[model samples]
Target: MVVKSHKIHDVEMVEALKEARQKIFTEIRKVIIGQDQVIEELLISLLARGHCLLIGVPGLAKTLLISTLAKVLRLKFNRIQFTPDLMPSDITGTEIIEDDHSTGKKVFKFVKGPVFANIVLADEINRTPPKTQAALLQAMQEHEVTAAGTTYKLKEPFFVLATQNPIEQEGTYPLPEAQLDRFMFNLWVDYPSEQEEIQIVQYTTSAYSGQPQVVLDAEDITAFQDLVRRVPVATNVVDFAVKLVRMTRPNFDQSPKFVKDWIAWGAGPRASQYLILGAKTRCILDGRPTPEIEDIRAVAKPVLRHRLVTNFNAEAEGVDTIEIIERLLEKV
Candidate 1:
């Protein structure tokens, strides 16, 4: 048997890539019982080339979802269990001393850590100290790591799927607003339904163990990303996305009355960028040639939730960011 590589420029290749994504999703469904919405949001973030912050109670299968996605995509996956004692060097690589026996000379060699993988699962991220969490900021934004005065480029399609337990606050260092802004989406995972829970238990206890099937490779994913970027958006759609982000700020004149009283800070330009990119990716996934206002509205919450800040009065009143966002959306 012989295998040949197909050129991406061929029209048939695009169809094949779409088929590959379908198969990838199907394979992921094998191990993952439910949380279809969570899976779709993760896929959008991946296609947008952006990171995600997943917040849910323990035992929601957040880690499993990320691992299953990485498995089907045939990408390298690494899980980092964030802890208070974890150091920045533990996530990023560090310089090590090495000796050249022939010349009897010692030199420093850079040892890469778990961050070198294509998909990184930052589990219980809030448990880690601030300094350790900061190590991921540059990589998530720039797709590269700088160490020992040398910059190393990460592989294409790099994604960081970070998970945090929302109920556990004690002994946990909450992520600062600045670092939270780096994520494109702040997804909230909910518990599975009774039927889904039964299926999960059956799948685990049955003899038919679910195994991930590789449906797409690195090159195919890169091509899909290019296609996602090519998805078109109308002028009004772009303006809607921009206005939606600007209206989140309390200080902005266009902001709603609720926003002015409840929100202490508004989203920045990055939120607008994420909103547009997220809509573009959603359109591509839905097989649409162009983005729509509906697509932007669907993704606005995840993109803007972390960017908006609540005032002390709002906190005292038991008002959350989501409520303020809903009001802004209604007014805008």
Candidate 2:
């Protein structure tokens, strides 16, 4: 791990956050039985000022995870249960006519939707149509909402943690790749282990008095995000991340044989950006001052998985993005 040797800014803040990580986990564990990796990735995206898309089947506690995390961070939380009838205005909000107190005249006022909060959980996001789904695109990318030709800035440390059901498709409108690209990390929430499931059942069936305490606020999160951006990475590590992202594109001459054979499309520059951001945050969360090439590789899968489009050969051969990414890691 080659890290540029230098004095990191806000050393005290980084050290405080590093120590607070265990406390945050302890609070989250009160409600969440397991899924440590999922929690870590969510925090990485949060601290990096990026959004995430969680793909998992129902009953995996996806909703609970984000909500619990919001509690742990002490951030304002909102949840929207996306459905077929959900409209774009239901997300970005709508303007209403109201009487003006000063002028005694009817005036239009914009009402903030669930998107105005610090952490918004787009539950069952794919259940909504593309038109409704695209409502979040701007807010996720620009941290602002437009209503009736007026733009309103979202609160600081804003994040949209969206969840999608991978098993159900009958009535679900799949999210387009363009919208998917807005997410920094496409995290997979897997099922709990047997023992963990047993613990979950017992815990839920019993008193279930678990409660998570707050660890940080909006301002604190914003400061840490700034700190993560300031973390130094060796130039070679950055080149490695760029090379890994470039290798995903099958048409590029530099891509490997397997990538060309199986992948029809590749990740764009945003993937590279997220790779570095996520890596830096992960490094800092572990009490390190700098990120390395291995940090880039560690964040590679979540950063690239949703951005990839496999060809027919891949589907026929049953090669998913996970396998493709694993091979890409080895190739890189």
Task: Tell me the lDDT of model 2 at 25.
Answer: 94
Give the C-alpha miss distance for residue 250 in model 2, angstroms. 1.1
lDDT score at residue 30, model 1, on the 0-100 scale = 84
Residue-wise C-alpha lDDT for candidate 1, range 262-304, written one tens digit per residue:
8888999999999999998887677666789899989988998
Write down the lDDT of every candidate, Cα atoms only.
0.85, 0.88
Q: Candidate 2 — which pairs collide?
A: none
In model 2, where do residues sit more than 4 Å from their true spots? 1-9
Clashes per model (N, Cα, C within 3 A) = 0, 0
- Deviation from native of the Cα of residue 230 in model 1, angstroms: 2.2
For model 2, what is the C-alpha lDDT against the true structure? 0.88
Q: Supply candidate 1's per-residue lDDT for 267.
A: 95
Residue 163, candidate 2: Cα error in Å is: 0.9
